[model samples]
Target: MSKHFLRPPGAVAEADFLGRCIRCGKCALACPYRAIRVAGLLDGLEIMGTPVILARKSPCYLCLKCVPVCPSGALESRVKKREQVRMGTARLNRKECLNWQGTFCRSCYDHCPLFNEAITMDGELRPVVNEKKCVGCGICEHVCPADPAAIIVTPRGAG
Candidate 1:
């Protein structure tokens, strides 16, 4: 299973985030969507109490509330607009997509926060992810009807 998960929006580089985060849970508290949660002990001591987001379960709405509330610089306050977030990038598994399989489906495209810019339907009426425009908010993955999801968000900095 993939261990990759997202940090709160505006999170700095991983190494700095791990060190600077004080585990105050302020970011989580600020989130109206409850999209932020503290990592538990099972997540490993290094990350325990650090904020995490399981996009499929609950994706960030890019409200930017978490950024200003962070006492630590873990989640940068500089991100004032939705377009500035770089949480990760969405990648589509064409083989798993219903549209690509000849059935009609546009859940991902319909649910994308960026709308037409982030996800668009091709000439075949299949969803195509615009990596450059995608904020990796995981809205598409969350709304996907396919089992295992036809698309997923890969956290920023994760290869």
Candidate 2:
């Protein structure tokens, strides 16, 4: 399993998700942010046409629109809060982060939808990720100004 790949909010566990998903593309169509995309032929037959979020290209905004449209139970329909979504966790690369290097930069912190909950400023004003509070929406990664984003969201269950 790729550590960088993410499913939409309310997605079931990997095994169950594969079994339950119908590849209807409804989830992709319903996404307001167009964050959800169908797995293409290169993704292999087992996951082809299934919904995936490529966070770097476009991160899930926690709009919750894709969940309700899933005809299959792959994504639960009852999750109502952004806090309830657990796509993955954000990992910070301090070496690449400007704030950690004594520069003033808060792009990751400023763009985080979870704000103070998912990302907080340390005494040095560097962004610190609170894994338990992070929903792995990848907004921080998308908004980062670095050549390689200083912060990245690792998908849940990834090794």
Candidate 3:
């Protein structure tokens, strides 16, 4: 066996797996919390249409959003945390969310003292990110009204 194994059983093959992804955007679509973002055709060859590049922006929490929609099996279903970690840190579960249904909830957005730090608003009145401003704080995760918390934080990982 190779002593330097690339991924643990639950680890994500971010580069290869993402490269193989068909750009279906299903992972981004299925995410009730909208945590995973499927890129467009021109973002970059490395990340175009694949799951959000954890490095260019934020990191992924353990929400497993991209894992479920990978029809091509490009994205692995399981990965040990020790095996890989991506760049971006704020992640949302969506399964336990109050915002997915369009309810009036802003616990996560409200408690974020650094309004422009980790989260921001779009013209549509939803939270958009100033990626450069984010500090990867877990305050949004702590204040989320969702049971599992629609949003959470992930540790910095090797993108």
TM-score of 3: 0.39
* Clashing pairs counted in every model: 0, 0, 9
The window of 10 residues in a row where model 3 has the poorest summed lDDT is 1-10
- A best-first ranking of the candidates according to their TM-score comes to 1, 2, 3
**Which sections of candidate 3 miss by over 4 Å?**
1-88, 93-96
Each model's RMSD to truth, in Å? Answer: 1.1, 1.4, 13.6
What TM-score fits each model?
0.97, 0.95, 0.39
lDDT of each: 0.90, 0.89, 0.50
Can you write out model 3's per-residue Cα lDDT over 123-157, one digit (the tens) per residue? 54565444455444445665666665676555335
lDDT of 1 by residue, 1-159 (tens): 136688888999889999999999999999999999899999888899999999889988888899999998988888999999999999999999989998889899888889999999988789998889988888888999999888999999886
Off by over 4 Å in 1: none
Which is the leading candidate under TM-score?
1
Candidate 1 clashes between residue pairs 3 or more apart in a chain or in different chains: none
What is the lDDT ranking, best to worst?
Answer: 1, 2, 3
Error of 1 at 49 (Å): 0.5
